[model samples]
Target: MNKLDLKVLDKQEDFFIINGKEFNIGFTNAEKERSFNRNTEEGIKELNSLKEEFGANEVIYLKQIHSDKILNYIENGKSIKDEEADAIITKEKGIIIGVFTADCVPIILVDEEKKVAAAIHSGWRGTYESITFKTIEKMKKEFSINVKNLKAYIGPHIRKCCYEVSEELKLKFIEKKTEIKKEDLFCGRNLNLEVCILDDLKKAGIQDENINSIDLCTYCSEDVKLHSYRKSQGSYGRMFSFIILR
Candidate 1:
């Protein structure tokens, strides 16, 4: 599905990160002809490797629908896997929760003190709905997490360099988020979706330094083998952004 013009890496490109000894996070690369969707043979194999590599017990996935709905492992438990949601959050350890994305943003939120982590799939729709801010609010209410302790890692997505939008869409977004000036959202015909997310995070009390953004643009990156939906000529595979409390 995801067409790669460049030579594939000889091995897996592990974008692994460790936040002390509390958790492990990773974003898989499209270096190999692999898919992480559940029940697929390729997905199963790749996830097995992920479970082993991250020392996680079970891999958590959901029927993602690009909505702002959030699944909580503590309140709803594991059965929420069959549900449709754009975000998943939990304080439970040893289980890996992940989201699949091509050009859409995948966000990982972690509170080291509360040992709670969340994975959010924020496409333009979810960003417009403020899914990240809602996830943080849920985590705080459920687990009593301190917002200042939350570290948000925004995964790779289509940036403004290549994200061209229509005037009507820009006007709609500006109308919804009155606080955001027109100039901040648009660079000529291109729109920066991350600016809305940053504003949401700041409003939700996530500190500036605590927010980590992967500056790679999925649509135009020459070095990284990322799948981009906007660049998808019919079919485009998805990359995995996962986190586990170790």
Candidate 2:
């Protein structure tokens, strides 16, 4: 039920890049009120616009849970119900995998040769749980994706500037061997969850160069665009980081 405060990154446009493909990335500002309304026809309309921008039939969406589970599309006409997983993957061509996030990091994975892609919503819980690692592991095991050949983009989310945590959380990161310093733990009382996650990804084998981080701080700038839960008192609109195999 927690969501992000909708604030746009004026300098940051919605774009993604395939590992080796020339096809450009497309993004949606789900923070728009119309995009978040579950019962409103306008919500569906907004999705339709996304379809036009990124091909409607090719998109794949996941029901995100804070857990590390990952699902693959069967390429059938089944209802895309909310599944209790943090990530979704597919080998089906033209299917754009979608991951929702506010303050949590939204990650998109793509392997050009295999024509496979994945979307992961990595929250603090997921970071501690290593959901991103698990998703990469699944991609390697199920799709034969070579970790070295894979590429990932860390989308907009809460950064260390405003993401404060407790001593317990900081200890948790240390216990996990995160490379962040104790001083970088924002509020001086807690840990920087986002940095912890980035470190975890490196530990999990995501090459430093292969990773692209937007480096946006959601809580500091709440009035511009997009949504931030920490700044907006539990808003629901979510920005999407999605990718399709073309």
Candidate 3:
């Protein structure tokens, strides 16, 4: 497949259409009126509207504890409330899986042949735990998906330009994977998260050509509409990244 093509669905929503296919992958913006907060009545209404707008038969939104736990939607079969996981996978059509992120990386994986999809929330902690690799493994075991046939999309996040980390944390990452080079972690005190994610994907049998990044940095983008915890000093709304097998 070609690189994922991004199109603005409206002022508050953006959907990514995979080249030559009808993949329903998208991420919401910081639209005040259509917030997916789920904490207030208005927020709940907006979320319901989102579901209707996208034509999702079922939506699995997780609590997201920053762990490597992967939830299988088919096995769980609805009733996804209070589920603590950073990644969610499903093979059922119309079952949209979603994860919220502000500065953390939001990744969507799709196997068109098998009609299997996954949504992952990979923060620094989740990345260190190899959530992406774990999710891929779970998908393979449950849905018999081949990594070669999977298309991975890394969405907007706090890129290396603004994702500074402590030396101790950087050392921890290197210690976890000895093969990780210094250049991969150093971008002037910032970590090149996408590089690390790409490395893990490539190691897990995903082809270099099949992986793509949106390349938009949430923290550095001039567009104030994009949410970024780092840019807003931890006072930003979460953007919902979702995918459905249509």
What is the lDDT of every predicted structure here? 0.81, 0.65, 0.77
Error of 1 at 230 (Å): 1.6
Candidate 1 regions with alpha-carbon error over 4 angstroms: 1-12, 16-18, 75-78
TM-score of 3: 0.89
Best of the two (1, 3) by TM-score:
1
Pairs that clash in candidate 3? none
The prediction achieving the highest TM-score against the true structure is: 1
In candidate 2, what are the lDDT values of residues 4-48, reduced to their tens digit? 122322233443333346233444443334343233476445555
Q: What is the C-alpha RMSD of each candidate to the true structure, in Å?
A: 5.1, 5.2, 2.7
**Looking at model 3, how many pairs of residues clash?**
0
lDDT per residue as tens, model 3, 1-246: 234334433233344333326467777766452456555586556566656877877667788888999888774455664788899888877766788888899989999988888999999999988899888988888899988899898888888889889989888877886667878767667887877787778778898888877767788776535688777777636777888777
After best superposition, candidate 2 residue 108: deviation in angstroms? 0.8
Candidate 2 structure lDDT: 0.65
lDDT at residue 130 of model 3 (Cα atoms): 87
The TM-score values for the models, in the order shown, are 0.89, 0.81, 0.89
Worst lDDT 10-window in candidate 3: 1-10
Candidate 3 Cα deviation (angstroms), residue 26: 0.4
The superposed Cα distance between candidate 2 and the true structure at residue 76, in angstroms, equals 1.2
